[model samples]
Target: MNKIKKIGIIGAGNMGEALISGFLKSKIFSPQDVYASEIIEKRRKYITDNYHIESFDDTKKLVERSDLIIISVKPHNVKDVLESIRDNITPEKILVSIAAGIKLDFIRKNLPEGIPIIRVMPNIACFVREGMIAICPSDNTPKEKLEAVKEVLSILGRTIILDEKYFDAVTGLVGSGPAYIYLIIEALSDAGVRLGLPRDIAITLSAQTILGAGKMVLEINEHPAKLKDMVVTPGGTTIEGLLEMERGRVRATIIDAVIKATERAKELSKA
Candidate 1:
């Protein structure tokens, strides 16, 4: 029989809850194999009641028992969380952090030298198991542990292993990119409404269109420009809309937004 991996999660916020949901649904880990540390009494009750996993108010106790620990707290709370569990971290354990702007060195400075660490950027889409997760593992992280994380995170859609140097940019493009797509979706829905469609129908059409277009880009494996060309015929309605978008420099503006967000991510780490 295969050995079941024991996992512990620190923090019970949205991201933490998403991971628990993802982990359990994957069936890679069982309820008894998972533990959650939540300071809030209400959240502690919620996790135990809903998921039937062991929930604790003390993070250190959770760290001592689990084989793998996922630090899912916010960026600002990372240092505090690290300090709380650093003494308990063992060489055999793998610590995965989902907090943005917290670097591997920052985590290493707080913990014992050579403690295995993996940093991942997971977006809100993880709640729906359609997230684009970017992972950057430290030199000390074992291959087996990295593979374990990969298998578990597969429940939350596609996962990519990226250079730590590009993490901030990756966070900007995919981590924060969902909000940008949402804006476009809302605008498209508004356009449909302006054309006399009911609000619900407009929203459904706009959302499904984005979903279909995303699938095409992933499945077709053609240059986006080439795909856009396929949609335009001689001189058509699509061309007119494309010209308007170009005139407004919509593409360029979005590109600049990614750069700006990346810069901001770096800025957060400085303080």
Candidate 2:
């Protein structure tokens, strides 16, 4: 597909602002090429003043002016926004929806027939540009268009093209995964504090350790179990900690968390 010269975002919330920030910071699109539509006057003003991009209260106007339109509004608001822009959306404009639990077929049914639609599940980490994103395109979307969306998302972090069927699991894993990891970090910090470490130092060390371990898994491209074994020496403190965690069924609990979250995602999609 041809280069996407302009982008319109339908929300000015955290994720929407993150995309605008990512696009500008990556130099993929200049401020002039980006526009946002936000309902609140304060939010629109903030986007305009801070990002130096055009902001509107009218979704139709944003869609009319943009080449690529990102539906960044909450899932419940998606239908209304699509209804408002249905007349303005044409074959040339690419539509990408980042609203959680909103499927590609649902978007297709709401929009003009054969309008290219791409569904994306991106985590909150996007604000920091360390996001994990999953994209699934409708059958009508061309390969180039899908690639273009992926190219734009790559600016935020790793992008994976997956079948839409896996999106609920993706939502459970990477989308809600950050919160689980943050909880772990907090628990580790608490453990350190109990062991007599200063609170500030303990929190720093706990956060850094988790960050380094994640980096290792990504850079080394090795199975996490093998990496765990690498750190487990005979009669070591790590082994003792691992044993305690096993006794507490931490592994099973984490797995259950993902399973429960996936079920909730499925329920939300139906709503």
Clashing pairs in 2: none
lDDT for each residue of candidate 1 in 1-271, tens digit (9 for 90 to 100): 3222788999988889988887787776779889999888999999999989999998987998788799998789899998899787888888899877889888988898878899999887777788889998998887877887777777787999998999889878887889999999999999999999998999999999999988899999988899889999877899999999999999999999999999988887776
TM-score of each model, paired residue for residue: 0.91, 0.94
State model 1's lDDT.
0.86
| Residue-wise C-alpha lDDT for candidate 2, range 1-271, written one tens digit per residue | 4488899999989889988888888776799999999999999999999999999999988998998899999889999999999998998889999887899989999989979999999887777788999999999998888888888888888999999999999999988999999999999999999999999999999999998999999999999999999999999889999999999999999999999999998988999
Note the Cα lDDT for every prediction shown: 0.86, 0.91
Tell me how many clashing residue pairs each candidate has: 0, 0
For candidate 1, give the lDDT of residue 244.
98
Q: Which ranges of candidate 1 are over 4 A from the true structure? A: 1-4
> Model 2: number of clashes?
0
Worst window of 10 by summed lDDT in candidate 1:
1-10
